[model samples]
Structures are given as C-alpha cells and as structure tokens.
Target chain A: MTETPTSSHFKENAHAALHDAPLQKALQHVRVNFIDKRAKAVARLPEFEALRDSARDIKDHTLANLDLYIEAYEARVVAAGGHVHYAMTAKDGVDIVLKLCHERGAKAVTKGKSMIAEEMGLNAALEAAGIDPIETDLGEYIIQLRGEAPSHIIAPAVHLNKEQVEADFRRVHRDLPSDRDLSQPVQLLTEARGILRDKFLSADIGVTGANFLIAETGTSIIVTNEGNGDLTQILPKVHIVLASLEKIVPTLEDASQLLRVLARSATGQDMSVYTTLSTGPRRPGDPDGPEEYHVILIDNGRSSMLGGDFEDMLRCIRCGACMNHCPIYHAVGGHAYGSVYPGPMGAVLTPSLIGVEEGGQLPNASTFCGRCEAVCPVRIPLPNMMRHWREREFERHLSPKAMRYGIGFWAFFAKRPTLYRLSTNVAMRALHWLGRAKGRFASLPFAGGWTRYRDLPAPQGATFQSQWRAKSGSVH
Target chain B: MSAREEILANIRRSLGVTGAEAPRRMAVDDRLAQARSGIIPQRGQGDQAARVATFKDEAERAQASVVEVETAADAPGEIARFLRDSNLPATLRMGDDPRLAAMPWSATALDTAHGASDGHDLNAVSAAFAAIAESGTLALVSGPDNPTTLNFLPDNHFVVVAASDIVGDYESVWRKLRGGYGKGAMPRTVNFITGPSRSADIEQTLLLGAHGPRRLHIVIVKGA
Candidate 1:
C-alpha cells in the first residue's frame, strides 16, 4: 500500500516480492482459491455471459454520464443531511480528511476497509496529522499492525498464515501470557477482540471505504464479513466515507445488481456476511449513529478514463474476479504487477491511473490470456485494455527499447510472410538441433524463465504454414 | 474560490477533461427501479438451507464450533461454560433479543446488560436481533437490550439464536428488511457476525483475535 510497485522503476520491489517465500505462499493460496471459487460461481450461472454483458453495458452507460451521476449523488447526500467533499487527487482527498479530523480535534480514528484510502495513503497522512487510525476490519487491522500494504484487494492479508499472527500478538501484547496456546484459531480471535474493542468505543472519528454510492438515496453500501464497518460507521461521533468517484451507482437498484456480482465473484458466496446501506448521518431522534457524516468522492485520475476507449475501466466493481481467474496472475501473484492495485486489473488500472511514465511496464506483464475477460462480471475486456496500455506506453516512449525493437521486428516479419516462413523454418531447425532433448528442450534462447519452470517441447520439423501450403498444393 | 468548484476544476484538469466533456449516454431515472429491487430468483425450498449448511461445515472445518438450539435461554450457561473452559473471564457481552429478554435469567449472577455501555466487565450477556442461517451469521442490532458495542468490545462475546429466526438466504433477509421496515427507519447498527474477528496479516499467519472478540460463543436455547 505504501509503495507503487507498478512504476517502471520498482523492479527491485517486484523482484523481492517474487522471491519472498511467505509472500509466494500467500499469493499461491489467493490465486488458487480465487480461480477455483470464481470458476465454480461462474459455472453456476446459466446466464453468466449475458449477465456480464448487462453489467458492462450498465457501467459503460453510467460512466459515459459520470459527471451527471456524481452531481446527483452529491445532491442526494446533501439532501439526506450529509456533506459531500470532492477530491481531485490523492493529496486533495488526504487534505480534506485531515482537515475534517482536525476540526473535530480527533486524536484517534477507527477505520473500515477501503482500498481507495490505502491507494491515497490516507493512514500516513492521518498519522502525520497526529490522529492514530485504528483499522477495525480484522484483515485491515492485521495488515495495519504489521505495517504493510494489502496484498489482495478483498482479503488484504490473504497471504498470511496463523503462526505468524501468534508472534505478532505476542510482540504487541507483552503483558499477556507469552505461552498462551494460540495454535488454535479461537485463541487468536480472543486476543484481537480484547485489543480492538477498546479502540472501537474510544476512537473519536470513524473512517470507512464505500463499496457503492447510490445517487438516488445518497446512500453508501459497505459489504464485509466482520461487523467492523457497522461499528466504524455508527460508533464514532464523526464518520468519513472515502470512495473513488467511479463507485457511484445511479440508484440503490443498480447498487444491488453490482453487489450481487460482487460477493459471488470475490468470495464464491451468495452474499457477504454484512451488506450494509448507510444513508448519510443518523437523522434527528436517532440515538446510536454518527452525529456528522462526510463523503469524500476521490477522482485521483479516474475521470480521465470516462469517455475514452479505456472508459470501460470505470465499470470495474473491484470484485477482483479477473485477477482471480488469470493464469498469469496465478503464477506471478499481485506484487509482481507492482502497484497498489495488482494482478490483471492492476496491469490495466495502474498504467491508466499513473500514466505510462511510471506504470508502463505493468501492461506488458500479461500473457494476453482472455481468462480475465471471461471471468470479469462486468465483462471489461481486460486483455484488450492491457494491450491498449501497452500501445499507449509505446506511443509515449515508456516501453523498454529491447521490447520495442522485438515488437518492431515481429511486425516487419509478419508483413513479409513468405520470407518470415523461410527464415523461421531455418531458425527453428537450427534451434531444435541445438536444444532438443528427446522430444522436449531443457533450455532455449530468450526463454530462460519458461525453461526454468518446465521443459519446453521441441519445434516440429516443418513449419505449420509450410504444412498448410503443402496440403493446399500451393507450394508451387 | 468555493470548495466545490475548486475541487471540480482540479479534478477536471488532472483528468485532462478541462476543455471538453464526454457526451452523456444515460440518465439516473433510467436505472432506479432495477437497482432497488435486488431480487435473485428464489431457489427451491431448502436449497438455501443446504448451501448454509455447507458454509457452516466450512466454518466448522476451520475449527469454530456450531450448534443449533430451540430457544435463547440455554445460551447463557453454554457460553459461560465455554468461556470457563477457555480460561477467559466470566464477564461477557450479550446481544439484545426479545426471546433472550423472555428468558428468565434470575438464576445466573454474571453481568447481564445491553448498548454501547462500558464493557470492562468480563462476562456480558445479550441476544441476537436476528440469526441469518444462510451464512451462519448472527445479526446484532443496536437497541436497549442489545448494545452494538457489546458485540465488538468484549474479549469473549456470546450470541443467542432462536432456530425460528434463521432465514434461508441473504436475499430473503434483504426482502425482510426492505418489505417490513416502515418508511424513514433504519437500525442504529446492524451487525452480521459470521466468525470471530480474524486476520492473517503477519506472514500470512491467520490471527483470530487481532481487533475484536477472540472467542465467539453461540447459545441456542429451547422454546423461549
């Protein structure tokens, strides 16, 4: 969360994450579970493709009129007695939240999980302003305590194991019996509950991430497994809901439709444990809700995506289904993508948000596997989007010189098919003689990574084009 | 000069939409009805329950205990014993429920209380506002008997459920909330707790109680 791994320069971070054993294990678990669960969920729906198309069309239509929907959402929230704040950038979002926290003289804040907040680096800003932000979501709290960015979108700490948590608790709670048997799962929960309970009641400000913003009702929906979002929204005197501007849905009905795909795609569940709809602050005569509510709508480079070819990117619900189902994502994991958002979505979103200068390499991280597009509920053509990012990156001179040259060579060769076929046949015969071991090759030129993992089958003696030509009697 | 304009202008510039805006494609009124009517086709009777059982089985496999009882009265003693066995304090926080209120708790001496109150007391007893059987979730709504804070603040939290309150699906619960609630009414807080507070942040190690109740005790009592 702290570092932008997608930036062209963060190769060091990517390399580190790629090799980190525990990180690798965690990534494997997320990749496998998400892929399997999403496959099963998609299989259950007879109209999966049609539903995806509908969701995509709805999102596209809404985004095309994003400005209108945002205005309407703001009006509704204001009418519902909530104040709306627009943030043009991450800095603006942080500044607004900091100002609100300062106005309330807040020293501590209880937080609900919001990836956008993490994207904007909100916690550091609050801490710098002297407000201790308490992450109330169990996963968020764990990552916060560990002082790390979330590895996955929905399950922030999906990469972690149980024993490591025991060590962290022991380190933080020194007074507790160090020997407290925590190998059992319940014991760990008991320890965390004991600590976070005090923070929930005592924190002066509550911060949450909004899943969807319904323009019609001026309501925000937050879906979670733990009940922290409810406490984060209701317990504090001041509640600040942070969300990306693209999250706006025209109506509660649209919000529900999105939520339907959301839980099923993310966790293979009919619905999350908690699907809460909060409309502004508590009304008059309401006793137990926040006295003041603030909705900070963050653009942070999103609106630029509205009408362009990449406009469909706004339709993403952050369901992470595409990333979950991507084979390349499974093998490489999120950290390899090098951004706050990662995996296939990150490959497209990171470059889109940060521009090609920093995030260009992200798009090239994909294999153009259409699995992401197939699994995406909103049916965003993620591979195509990544390709666009690649094209943009190339146009802006962000792609590496070597890759650019390689692409140029391929393009040139593709145009001269007869020469390309002749050249490739000769090259393939030479490489086969040099590399073949029985039927497979143990090593190949310019493909060390692939060869490192598994054996690469040797090339056939004749080229496919040549075989086709012979069959068609066109060789003469 | 104004906050709204400044914010909007800044966003427009950064997004590079300062000069021209995209043509509007759809309006809000066009999408209202479908958004609010979040209906999923109702599965045949008992299919939802079967799915819920699978979820419960998954939770059980992960080591949390699951039990079903007829009423709320039997909850206090079971939770007390569980806490005792776990060596946690006798003080517990209980959710507020009518069935729980119906139970005669004069027999037990531990702290009996309900809403955002100080939970320094170890053993607090309350009732679940609703039990969502679909996810094996216990809904805790903020009220006089069931304080929202009690569900989160206590180290050892006990949830009492009546088998009858169990609904088959989340959609059913939504329908109940939507169709039944009067206009302009919302609970102060509605908590749907599936498992105890858990995190797997440290080296991917799953930590059970990093922020909320470490132990979740569910008491299913006989007909209240």
Candidate 2:
C-alpha cells in the first residue's frame, strides 16, 4: 500500500518547475483554456449550482451509508453474474489483478485512464509479472511511452507541448515513415488511433476506472469523450474495473445527478461523447462484449477517512475543476506537487491517503485563494481541509524547526497585548525611518525568501492597534 | 479476517455504525427503489413537437447529422443517402434487430451485412432504445438485437430512433429502462452517446473519430 512519496521535497520540485522553460510554456494553456470554457458552460445552465448542491448531498449520504451500500452493491453484482473483489490495500488490488490475468493467460492488457491504477502503481506490477500493459487513452498513451506520471488528472500530458509529443511519437513509432505529415494535432491523434486500435483488438484483458458505481443495478459507469474506455471494456475477454470504495452511489438517478455537473466541470461539455453504464459480462444472447466482469473495490486508507475532518475530500468526482481554476496549478503545473493527484485536491487528499509525515509539505503549497472550493462541483471545502492537515502537521511535529520556532515566537508576543504593541510600534518606527527614502526593501535581514523575489513595501510608522485607537469613532 | 470482512469492519468502525442498522439499510433500499430524479434542467422540457425540435437542434450542435423520415420503412433510404453524400462505402453492418431487419432494404441499392462488427466495416446502423432531448443523447442497450459493436466499431453509424421514443430528460429514459428490464435490473450495457467519438487530449484541440464512429447519422422515424 505504501509507495515512496516525493511530496516531502515539494519546494525543490516547485523551484525546478518554475525554471523549466518548455514546461512553463505548456502550463500557460491551462490558464487560457479551462477558465472561460467552464464559465461559459456554467452560464448556460442556471440549475448548475443547485445541481452541485444535490450532487454534494448525494455523495455525503453515500459515504455515511457506505458499508450498507457496499453490501447491497456486492449482492447486485453477484446476481448479475459479475465477480466482486475487496482489496484492503494497493498491493491487494495489484495482486487481485495479477491473479485474474494469470488465470486467463493474458499476454496483453489494455487500460483506460484510471487514476486509481496510477495510485496503485499497477502497470509496474503487471510488467513485473510479465504481462504487457497498454494505456489506451491518447493522453495516457503519450505519458506511458515517455515513461512519466500524469501531470494533470483529466489531461495526463498537460505539462507537454505538441513539439514534445511529436518528438516522442517519432521516437517510438519508428515503424511509420520518418517524414509523414505529422505537424497537426489531428495528424497526431490519427496516428495514436491507428496504433491503439490494434492493441484494443488483440489485448486479452481490459481495465478501467469507474466514474460512478451504481449500487441499485450493480453497474459501473465510465464517462469519456474519446470512447477508448468503451473499446477497452468491449473488445476484450475480461474486464476488470478498478474503483475506490467511495465511488458507490445508490441508483441511476443518483449517478445522473452527479453526471450533470461532471462533464461540465471537467472539460465543459454538456455530456461526453460516451457515457457507458455496464452491468456485467455479456448476456446470453449478446454478440459482443467481454466474457468476464470483475470489480475491485480498494480501501487503501479511505475507510479511515470516513467521519474524519478530511471526509469531505472523498466527495471529489475527479472533475479537475479545482485544479483548472487553481492559481498555484497554473503557476507550477501538476508535476510540482509530486503526487498521483495534484493541485488543491491533492494538497488535501495526499495527506489522508499517504500519512501526514511524508505528505505534510503538500498542504503548505497553497495560497488559500478559495477558487478551488468555489469551482468544485462537489463543493469540497478544500482550503478548510488543507488547514486541518496543517493543524495535524503542527500537532504531530512534522513541521520544520524554523517554522515551529517562528510561530512560537509570534505566540509568545500574542499572549501579552502591551508587550506585543510596544515591540511592533518601535520596530515599525525604526523601519519606516530607515527605508523612507527608497520606500521599499530589496533585501531584509533574515527575510531573504520574500526579498529575493520582490521588494517588500516600507512599513508604516504606526501599528494598526495604535492607529485604530487614535482614530476610533471619529472617521465613521 | 478476510479482506472483505476487514474492510467492511473498518468502514463500520470509522462511520460509527454496525452493518445491521435498520434505518441505514432502509435508507439505501428506499433510495434505490424510489430512484427519484433530483433536478431536471428546464432547457429540454416542452410539448412533443417542441421537444423533437430541441432534440434535433441539440444533436446537430453535438456534431451529429439528423434526418427525419416519414416512417420506419424510409429509414434505409436516408441512411443510404447519407452514405452516398458522405462518400463512404455503400455497405453497412448491423445485428439481428427486428426493427432494422423489417426495414425495406430493397428500396435502396446498398449492400448490408449482419451481426456485430469485427472492426472492418465502414458503416453500420442500429436502433436506439431511446432518444434524449436534453443533451441530444441516444440510449442504446446491448443485446442480440443491437450488438454493442455496431455502435462503436464503424466509421459512420446510423441510428434509427422512433419519433415517439424521444424523451425530455435522462430520468425518462431510466423510467423506460425500468419498465422494460424490470426494477433494479439493466441490460449488459446502456450507452448514452451524445455525439461521434472525439478527443481534446492533444493540446485541448477537439478532434472527431478518436477510436469510434466518426459520423453519427440519426434517421428519426416520424409518424411511424
């Protein structure tokens, strides 16, 4: 269940991301593209906010009754002739998938874009077991060939430009002519389509992540615009659905309520090109689809998140809206966070999934701007959760010595009003007199982190308490 | 403890409840049985003619071609015409759908094959279980009647949806499915396809025909 977390070195990753020229160029697109499209989509639907509230309520209800719902869901799946496996950890999930693949003698496995798979590190496990795993989503395919993790949740290759993709394709797709008309985005999509279509046909097993798993009918739903997920499930002999425990909803109508906001928040589409609800393996008379269906329900610390301060984070639908509207994500891209999930959602969730000790630095990577909470389709209180993680980090002594000492120093003064006022007033007067000529400080003693980037404004001579005390009731 | 039992035990522990809690079980059962529609958007609600108009408009907006025929018998001709107009091959593959089999294919000089796709056909046609006005989606169920492959494997997909089957929202389709497949049961697959296959993965530039039908032609059977 435990993987090495690079989140402890977030500062270095963020610094490197800031200086990466091509990556900075690629990160600019997220700022330009998703904001207006989502705004326009929201503007078109007047019931969007109300629907978001409804979606939130549904998820809350499901989580509160998750154990019962899981029992109901498993019963329904078995009745439909599909198998259900409960995986207590990431390794358990990998082992279940490997055993299934080994039973089928599956040489090649095609995969839809599943962040759960990424979180479990499933591809590496499959390769270790000697089965080839092929990513079928165009974005996942690009990142797989380049041997990197997804930078963004919905768009895996968001940190790369077209030239970089063209180079990767040219390097890997050596069977094609070196100088075919590969300049346009459509040309690149066409090449991936042609290549992946063969893998889809021949792969013996398929794996996908569920957008929603309906307990009412034992159905697993996947929504995609590219239709790769449908092909991955339909064209194989075995279909294995990888889902976390919180994905279960009660009924089709409940799933519909969430779907109303999902595509609109993710890519600003009214509905994706394909929204498939698959119940089980092929029916008796069915001419197409897989012969076996299995759903792997993974806990991996999510059950512990229930009824905790971070419980709200489980309401996430992975819409990518929080990241799309995130200022920090736009500045540094997703790789800077150094987690499978990134941006504001990752900041709150990474600590819950992985411990606060290793993931303590992630929640501190935010500006607390509130845009993530505002744009979230499920209205997860992301900033508040990050604040909770910060409190836990402080309580657990995971914060650095300098930060703890700085806060201790401030707390000492905060306990005594008169002493705090005297010290601040004297220091403000001294700084004002010293920097009045320049009106800003290019460098300040013991404050190089701030002064290194930009100038700090000269302090006012009077403290806020003194000014307020003198001007009380007169200005108004 | 088994993984399943242990996981459930941990969830119950964290949630502060036993699995035998009556009210919780009742809540889950009630929600599933009721299957209530939460919030239906107002954009697609209207009378029949207005609903049909909105359906066609939304389908076209999603980049699918919409054509109306007088009856089910005339659907083949329109599909054949669509193939001719698009400069695609004059051949189509389909399943053993009774509605499609009953069509008068002799009315057009087009070649047709039967039973699910093996990824070689250029054109295929199927009968939609229902058509949604809101979001312009077509609901297709998997069976011997309309194999799932016919919907995705072909380059050009022609769907024959009866005019009377168009609904105002997705909830209505759910009601229809419940009536057909019984409560708490579903077909092997229920596909809600809004448009032809597409992807914006490449630098967020929208491109059609990414591993599914490039063209979706809907032949609405009016007054059938």
- Best model number under lDDT: 2
Candidate 2 has what TM-score? 0.98
TM-score of chain B of each: 0.71, 0.98
User: What lDDT tens digits, residue by residue, belong to model 1 across residues A269-302?
Assistant: 5456566677767655443678898999887777
- In model 2, pairs of residues that clash are none
CAPRI docking class of candidate 1:
acceptable
Error of 2 at B58 (Å): 1.7
Evaluate candidate 2 and give its CAPRI docking class based on DockQ.
Answer: high
lDDT, candidate 2, A1-476, per-residue tens: 21356889999999899999999998888898888888888898999999999999999999999998999899999999999999999989999999999998999999999999999999989998999999999999999999888989999999988889999999999999997988999999999999998999999999999999999999999999888999999999999999999999999999989999999999888888899999989999889999999999999999999998989999999999999999889988998888889999999999888889888999998899999999999999999999999999999999999999999999999999989999999999999999999999999997999999999999988988898988996777
Worst 10-residue stretch by lDDT in candidate 1 chain A?
A1-10
Quote the RMSD, in angstroms, for model 2. 1.3
lDDT of each: 0.69, 0.92
Clashes, model 2: 0
